[model samples]
Target: MIVQTLPGRRAFIRENTRLQAPPHTPELSLHLADEVTPIWRLTEEALEEIGLPPPFWAFAWAGGQALARYVLDHPDIVAGRRVVDFATGSGIVAIAAMKAGARRVLATDIDVFCEAAVGLNAEANAVAVDFTDQNLLNAPPPQADVLLAGDICYERPMAEAVMAWLRRGREAGARVLIGDPGRTYFPKDGLEKLAEYQVPTTRELEDLAVKRTSVWTLP
Candidate 1:
């Protein structure tokens, strides 16, 4: 159960997830875990024993779904631009940006499993997305035309750090966007609302079957 190689991770993902479209972004497909998947039943302790982090990359969270939907619907935002999808779980937003005609996209996450997940999902959607395991927060602001983050404000320290980094990206002239479903730590000010959606999710993941999520950009 300990996945140490890319092939092992890919096999685990293939065995534990199904190729399905998120309810709010049906145009794209991803390898995702549902209630019926074995990964969904793993407890935190179980995951820790297996040397796996929480399988966040295996679920299309409501905020990510909303952001992906908005990107697909507003192609002009990323058309011909370079994009970086922060915390690119399942590579949903990155794929959406590529489908919307972005010249290139780099998907970054700290989880090692996410590299495989993003690769598989991008291949499924017939788009090529670059993946990185480096923690972008440790470096200078990303050099790209657009920066996208989704569902990242669950914890206060992490949310504050990420928001500060995103603000730096905005100051450096990159368009910064975020998608959140009313997370406790998400800042309530200084963002322009772009779109909102009632994204369908599982209770096991969100405690609610549908989440009212919104996409916002730094003004």
Candidate 2:
């Protein structure tokens, strides 16, 4: 508790978690918490003592897993392009883009701890991925050839905000891709399904142990 610095937060992550491959994306490995409940409970309690939010950076969610798998399979989507992974938790999709031979990859998240997590995961995967702690929600979409977002539609407001920003990215001529595990706020219209996967996840993270996640592009 009380992790005030980036190093302190990184150390807490390293101590509480282990480097392992997510079940749905075995090609890449990340430093992740072992059980969802322990870290969830700890972060919940630490909210008062540490002023840290829930450790979303510690788990590979179903949407990220399926998106990573899709990227690895469809290298042409990112090959030689500047890619941005928005709301990158655990940096799974950004790492996958790098491994798929992207010219560059930038992973962005609101949590500063995610910078450390993304850096560690990039090093482990032998891919160079840049990280940013800025929220980038209200700002203009940064220049990129492609934008990847996974599991971003969990809440109504967040889903609406990011969708609008992502649409701006698409209008600016960047291909925007979203991965969702049937989140309620996902705009069912105007998205072309690029790929789908049966992503295995812990029940602690979702209602089902196996989630059918899909990758969609605005076209």
lDDT of 1 by residue, 70-115 (tens): 9999999999999999999889999999999999999999876899
Q: How would you encode candidate 2's per-residue C-alpha lDDT over 1-219 as one tens digit per residue?
A: 555676777777787889999998898999998777788676556444564556789999998998889899989999999999999989999999999999999999987578888988898999899888888987999999999999998789999999999999999999988889999998869889988889899877889999999999999
Best by lDDT: 1
Instruction: Point out the worst 10-residue segment of candidate 1 by lDDT.
Output: 40-49
> Where does model 1 exceed 4 Å of error?
40-53
TM-score of each predicted structure versus truth: 0.93, 0.94
Candidate 2 colliding pairs, count: 0
lDDT for each candidate structure: 0.89, 0.89
Looking at model 1, residue 37 earns an lDDT score of 40
